[model samples]
Target: MEHSFHYLLLANQATVHRQLLAKLKDTGLTLGQPKVLDYLQDHDGANQAEIARACHIEPASLTSVLNRMEVKALVERRTQKGDRRSFAVYLTGQGHSMALRVRQAFEELEEQAFAGVSEAEREQFLAVFRRVYGNLKEGER
Candidate 1:
């Protein structure tokens, strides 16, 4: 039985995500939390809306994550300068250290996921994946 391309693609993604999540569990972080920290590592002091967009999460969901992280002392939200209505998200020292570990974990997970694939095959996979992404994105327009 042949699996549809979408099914195979999504299955592979889910498997890899699960493995990564498991590894992150040892660090006392979850999938959602690492996403926020990863974004902050690249774009520090971004407002909540910006972080949500970059992390591809909803505002409501991001708010809940931020609240939890604040309680953990992983991040702090401060009013944006000259913008009382907007709050910027900043990683605490602990968050910065955690972000590095999270980054390493993700990299290791990806490496493990593609372990058996040849370099040529990996390149082909990425090219095909990007085409698939473009096709789906274009369809949405």
Candidate 2:
């Protein structure tokens, strides 16, 4: 099979994700969990639906992830006022501390991924990536 830009893109993404996951293993965080923690770091107390949308995950999948996070003592879910079926999510103290570590780990991983790439080349790659991302999202509502 001939490799194309899409192949390279996905391959790179997989490599980066693998590296981040390895680093996060010590903290007991999985691949997608960091994205949720990062979102809640800024938007603490968001409801599950809001978090699902923000995290680009299905509500059912988010429910599972939140359950795991809760078990890990990283987050808490509270019943929302006037809505028994709804709950607001908040990061626990431990969650907040782990979020900081997650952020640092991601920074280090990113640096490692881009090591030895010149600033100009990095900027050019980013510009191209933005255009590609926009193109892919053109039909998104």
Candidate 3:
């Protein structure tokens, strides 16, 4: 079990999580924030539900995240036309700039993660990983 792929994968995931936290420290961002920033990079003006679905975040949790972001002046929720209770979220100027930094940070991490691998090896590994993920997803249903 110590040397199993599943065990090693979990360890790698933890390492990546730590690395992400370290990278995000400078931006004054946290885990859920980056997901939202990445989502809003191209989908500015998205509604709460849309952002939640895209970011794989629960609606209730997303509300809190958005509320915190609003406090940071990273996003603003405006009333959607014809919808009094629903709002469309837009990145503030600061959020737009932060989004770019988030993208850069993710790119750098990806590059670092695969620093030594050949393109062919990376492609093959990802293909197998996808297949394994699909199998697990199917088993859940």
Worst 10 residues of 1 by lDDT: 23-32
In order, what is each prediction's RMSD in angstroms? 2.0, 2.0, 1.9
In candidate 2, stretches whose alpha carbon ends up further than 4 angstroms from where it belongs are 1-3
What TM-score does each of the candidates earn? 0.86, 0.86, 0.86
Q: Name every residue pair that clashes in candidate 3.
A: none
Candidate 3 ranges with C-alpha deviation above 4 Å:
139-141
**lDDT per residue as tens, model 1, 1-141:** 239887887788788778778877777776589889888999889999899878888999999999999998889999987778899999999999988988888889879878999999999999998998889979978
Alpha-carbon lDDT of model 2: 0.89
Candidate 3 structure quality by residue, lDDT tens digits, 5-39: 99999998787767877888887887789879989
Model 2: lowest-lDDT 10 consecutive positions: 1-10
- Local distance difference test, candidate 1: 0.87
TM-score of candidate 1 relative to the true fold: 0.86
Q: Which candidate, 2 or 3, would have the higher TM-score against the true structure? A: 2
- Candidate 3 weakest lDDT stretch, 10 residues: 12-21
- Cα lDDT for residue 29, model 1? 71
